[model samples]
Target: MSSRAPWIVFGSALAGYLAVGITLSLRFGFILGDALSRTAAAQAVLLSRDPHVSAIGFIFTPLTGLAQLPMVAFASWWPAITRWNISGITVSAAFMAGAVVMVHGICRDRGLPGRYRILITVVFAINPMIVFYGANGMSEAGFLFLLCWAVRRLIRWVGTDDVHDLLLAGIALGLAFLARYEGVVPIALAAVLVAVVTACRRGREHWKDMRRRAVLDAVLISGPGTAMFLVWITTSWLITGEALAQLSSSYGNTAILTQSGGASGDLVQTTAFSLGAFIALGPTLLVTFPLAVVLATRRRDLEFVVAPLLFGGVLAFQAGSYITGSTFGFLRFFICAIPLAAVVVVQLFPAAGDLPTRRAGAYRRHRPSCPPMRTAAAVAAAVLCVSALPVTAWAMLQPSLSSQQYALGYLLAGDPSAADSEATTARRVIDSFATERELAAYLDGQALPDGSILVDSVYGFAVLAASEYPRRFVIPSDLDFTQILNDPAAAGVRYLLTVPNEGRGVSDAINRRYPTIYDNGAQLYPLELEVPNTGADQPDWRLYRVPS
Candidate 1:
């Protein structure tokens, strides 16, 4: 248990986690999900108006909008996932740095040997989801860091029965929840454990004293967390018109949740995959399960204290989710429990006593030497770290890695090569419509400048057109919607932008009534001709010029 061993293990673990993060980011970089998330962040940045302002208006902006401020500031900074992806990296790194400190704090407090401490650090660094999800720009990494830090604080508080400690725990949990909704699980669990511990004190005087302190701790901890929560809700309402709009508009929508009706399968598969990752990581459930088994017979009291916290966190997370795919792909959601599992594994093996100390205390204070086990464990840990390389490499080549296969693999992987490939393919596919660009150029060159132009393409057409002529263009948010029927553009638009992505319903509604003013693979039609009314699918697109 050399003192320097922890540092060695820390460096090795960090290197491995970063290797996986970089690989996934480059591979999945071009995915639409990454792009959309980047766009959302970019839009947030654009809306910031002033990055240095720090006004309530800055805070009032939606999170998505604020995340994009960096992107909006520098157009050349365009990356598929927004320039703020760097912020995501910062957030993840902050949490991880905190965890490393927390691990050292816990090891010192417990007076564990260097080998045991190194093993615990190894457990944390190699946790699979931690490596994969923490590397992305999402809140999962920060949230996990807070959750782990809070648990460490809770452990210390329990030992000292300190109100300040409890308050710190509360603040961490509150901030974790602010980062992501799923953070409430660990927060609630910690509160419950504190309450139970207070209630279990033996003497009447001790019980009363502990109870009073417990209540005070609860108040101090819960107060700031509650206030922050309310602030989050208020901020959401100011931006989106509702307090829970982000969750309600997307995750809670039943249409998306039960898209195929057999959502049970999705849930089952996700649960299985999550469980599998936990085992594969070798530091989490793999360590905890063995600890639980060994402790049940050898140290039942410690098992009672640890098992419930471990199991409860997992159960609470599972119970809270409403949708199937919500937990399916991203392992980051499960990283919250990794620290607990690592603690359990560390606690499972009794430390080997110093030879002189053992001789001094003899039977009165003897502990097993853990140094021998450290060498074997280090070897095993090295093998596990090496095993991840092939899995990561294989992940890079899969179609899911190259595409936004959110249903199957890590969401934050952000494969840059894959993203670049997709971007190229999207451009090529869009370029096939030579006429769309021609009409767009012609429209840009036109005299009319104050009205909207209708269009049907999803990404390239709408993005390019809108980017080129912001005021005169209007795009459908719905990817599958047909043309503007009653001609909303008729009232104001001087011209139309059409693309092949539009199906029959659009052409049937407007093509017969509008004469072809310009025809190409991308067609431009004048609203001067007459046509019948029928709700049917039609050809790609024809731009029409409405007479003023």
Candidate 2:
């Protein structure tokens, strides 16, 4: 493998994705609320009055926030980075660039020609799901980076019996959990695969000895991920008082999903819901998927099994989750299938120089029927990979398929009528960002002492991040947040920034504490301002004064 190939892929991808991200964010004012929330959480670590690592919040996995720290640190002076969520874009772009490099590595490892490697990598890089998530600063890009890294390492370990490869794969899967909660699916599947492969490798060994070897090898491959999983829960329990706050907290996933009225269908409906997303973004899965599964069974090859189980397992888990009403049917949710399919392409039709398989195949008698048949499949895979781009671009404009940014597609196509009221309003959505600035400006002018303005980072993260004086606000990340929230007036908190008690807003800390506070200040506090939500994807904010 040429060492320079990865750098070329990474550098080009980084530059191209950064350009798209920055243009969409700065030039067109397109940004994502989830991405902004991550940036806000990262800022809590360095800019909050408490200024502790734990300030990064516990609801979401920590690595994405932790990953933003380096860029988030600059937000103090480079306000635009946080204001426009540019720092998040930078992080996502970098991770996605790295993900593309992993896809390139798989192509090389499978002995694909240089041109085919370039084609596979390019197809993955230019996919709409990849480009959008890579620029949007969500955890998907980083999660994909870790997932792809782990997949390549797993394939290498399966072929070479390299402990180092196994360990590296395990470590990546471990960190992948910190990137996205769904990572647990891969970690579990990888362990099972490792055990199966290890046991099957024993030919003349004792049954007990083979069993022992299989168990140890499985543990070795999965130990890091298991440990990391424990560490994450322990950390969250310590700070948030709930081990799975990301799921159970009032401001957590279940609360938000319920509030948004998500998971609107039965099992079959949800399955179709998920499949539509997968088909739109990962059309290449159509061919590679069957080929991957059939080849592993036909050849009984452990190496070929890596693609279907390691990567395809995650895809299946997402589909299952949707079918079970565990996750929303988002286009980006099935993005890993893109790389899974690309890797399967290489596995299905590796060229003669595929070193790993060549060495392992010493015991095998199976071969392709003829070179022409293999060539035909390889060409078809490449064609599908290229075709996925336009197919995805078309899918991105359909709101039912591309829930997150389908409006952007319509807006770009100059068909504003095709988009909904929210989309029409979102094209000029910077008003909400400015509204946060205005609110922060008002709070900063009051010269509130530290912990004077009580707000939950769940929804108020935008205002907290926009403020020049973040210390003036007492967020959940604060060491004394619970104390201040209990009796704001007694705790010297002068103001409460709250959202109306409706939908997800009711889960906001303030609304829960004073259920009727948003309506009439609960007769205990005076309403100071009613800031109407001026942008899409945001709730109207209510500022109330706590009598001291």
Candidate 3:
């Protein structure tokens, strides 16, 4: 195979998806909130009144925002980048396309035929959920990329016992930890697999030797990720005085999940919801996963052990998190399962030509005496993968199944009626946050002084990022935020943006300081305007003119 084949696949995939991302932004106003919020944080590193590195954030892993920093820093020159969140879209599309390259590389390392590699990549790429995350500027795309990269290297290390491959895999996961906290599950699992595999292969009689080498290899594989996690928490603690702030902070994942009522469903129902999500995106996982384990057990083909388990472990961890009230019931959490299926499919089928030399416990090209049955099996696997697309598309359109996916689904559905609804709250419900943009524009027109507006970033990140004059507002990241929140009028604060004190809005600083601020300005300020919450997904915002 040409070394350039992966680059060609990457460039072609990137170009196509980057176009999809741009069109999604321009036509339907489709963008993910987490992406927007992360991009806002990235832009605030320089664009905010505080303009410090700590402005990036304290809780959620920072890689997604750090990846956007370069493009976000340029947002001043290209206003559309931050406003439309093209910076995030570009990062996601490029990372997703790189994931396509890793898919090809994984298949190739197992010596699969070119045609099979291309087939698996296409089937993986065409899944609507996959493409949506790739083009919509979410962390899932980057997480998928790093997950595949780690799995690919670990597969090689398990096959060849190359220390270099193991080290690179650890670094990929270390970076993945920065991408999403879910990376911890796979990193920990990978370390266990390394230790167990080493013990079994390296020591037949010398138990002590086996234990020592296994422990060492496990440390080599696990060290980087563990260190990264510790450093991240330490940094959060140093900055915010709260370690694991993502769980304890008012703006953290648990807070958001509790606030949204997402954790209120019964465990059995949520488990059922999880299985349905997996089936839609990775139906092949049902068949190929078992096949990988069977093949690994029978032929000592350890490549299958590392790849499937790394991806599968993450999926299990996410499903468990949702069931236990630790996270939201989002279909996107299962995206890793799609690539897991792709890796398994490529291994299940025989290549067009056998390898010149085979490594023991590596991939064994399955050779069935009945050639026709082999072809039939491969065809059936491919069919199972392709069939998932329509099921995934159907699932995305169902609000009960995927409220996060509805706007893109409506646009992709291509119904003229659905497109028309873009203006009627269908698109703006979550993605557009169109009212926030209108508020930003309205506020920009006023002669508001610097530090005149007081709003909590938890709810006001979008409006602040969208504003042409961002520094006019005094946000939580500002140094004097605590002092000013106590008595805004005396601190030169003029306007206050207050959301209804419900759900996630309960933590808003303004609401906390004066519980009746939104309803009656707590007898200290006057209501200037009320922006009705667009889709009932967010709170109705009340703008107050503080008596400064």
Candidate 4:
């Protein structure tokens, strides 16, 4: 295949992804799921009195929102851009497109045949999770792109022993850390691997020199990335008046773990479950991934081992999150490994007969042509790639459902609407509450004096997006629904909007704590306020007057 062929393929795939993303944004008015919160966060940052002290601090990382700032600013200047989620979707789609290109580059670096590289790149580019997240306004696509680029650079450094490559890898990893907190896993792993390799070289005559170099390498690789994280944390502290404010907040990972009662069992089980979830994302991977690993080990292939090790590091992070009960079941967390695993599976196969031959001794050694094992590997990989198609199609069609649903929804039914009816029902409730214009007008009309509203993070986004006075609202991360209700006036809250059908435990708690406020089941009546019932399956947004 020609050198230009992969670029052409990448371009085509990227165009396709962009088209899908644009279409979804046009149809839905926003990218679904967390994209809503992310968009709102970006808007909040742009509109906040002090961007540092805004609700953006309550979220995971500010990089995604900050990244959207330019586009958000552009949208403010150009009304046409606001019709769809052009900024967020474009950013995400661009990252995903870059990832596809990186996959091709990784394949090319590994000396895989052009056909195999193209095939692997296409498969990864169109994988359900990749397609869905790529087009949405989320951080996963950007994080995945940086991760693939960093891993590729790291592998190149390992092969060529070039310090420049190592530095580049560190830089990429550092940028990735800024993209998402999970990016630290690779940085930590790379540092530890450098130290381990240096220690294992102790028998050499230049052992002391190697040790010194290794220490420097480890520091160089981890230092910048660590610094980026520290700067963010320190800035957050200065802004929020709490060190580690991101993690200590109610929405923080540590708080979530504590709320979940911590990990229930051994770390091994958590790891296994996490790995299982990753495999379940691409079911055929269950067969092909292990076979590829075994074959790669038998062949003593560094590329294969390194790829899986990097992917394993990512899974280990997820497993840690699971074990600590910081997060339970979000498969997009594992999507970064999918492309890497696909590359490994494709590389496991023997190159096609037409491929150009490299110099005999230059690590392009061919196997002894074992038909049985080769055929088995090829068949397993084919099965895995083919198996992903159904889910990929479903996800492309229904990008609104969560990644877990994408992985398992098909088993419930073939038709997406039937398979994920629960999501549809929930969405109906959400749409009813998405009464941005109506709610904003009503709140403005009320003209309550010295009044502010308190809402959960989810509804906080809704309120912020719908209101002109977003700064007046408080989304207290430290308080629960009951706590907030106990002294709403003290918290400067004059009204509370509750969506009972959403099934948030806090919503249920609020209902139980103040049954009189919710006498009409899903409706609340206080200060003679009545929540309009939009329709059946719609969330009953019960607005209540907070007691002074």
Candidate 3, residues 388-490, lDDT tens digits: the string is 6787788887766676876554565433454475434454554456777778889989988788899998878888778877788888878889999998889
Clashing pairs in 4: none
Best by lDDT: 3
Candidate 2 stretches greater than 4 Å from native: 204-208, 292-300, 354-376, 411-434, 441-449
Local accuracy of candidate 1 as per-residue lDDT tens digits, 17-49: 445545544443321232234333343233322
**Candidate 2 whole-model C-alpha lDDT, 0 to 1:** 0.79
Query: Candidate 3: lDDT of 130?
Result: 76
User: If scored against the real structure, what TM-score would every candidate get?
Assistant: 0.60, 0.91, 0.92, 0.74
Q: Tens digits of per-residue lDDT for model 2 on 1-548?
A: 37677888899999998999998877766777788888888888998888999877778888888988998888777777777788889999999999999988878766677778888888888888889889888999999999999999888776667677778898999999989888998899998888877776756455455688779878987888889889888988986789998889887888788888877768777878788877777787786777777866766656777766766777888888778776777878888877877787777764334344424422232334233335677687788788878888898877678767676754453424544665565454533366676777777788668878899877787787677777788888788887888888888888889887887887888888889988899889999989987666677888899887
Error of model 1, residue 410, in angstroms: 13
TM-score-best of 3 and 4: 3
Model 1 quality (TM-score): 0.60
- Rank by TM-score, highest first: 3, 2, 4, 1
Positional deviation of 86 in candidate 2, in angstroms? 2.1
Q: Which has the better lDDT: candidate 1, or candidate 2?
A: 2
The model with the greater lDDT, 2 or 3, is: 3
Candidate 2 TM-score, true structure as reference: 0.91
Per-candidate alpha-carbon RMSD to the true structure: 10.0, 3.3, 3.6, 6.9
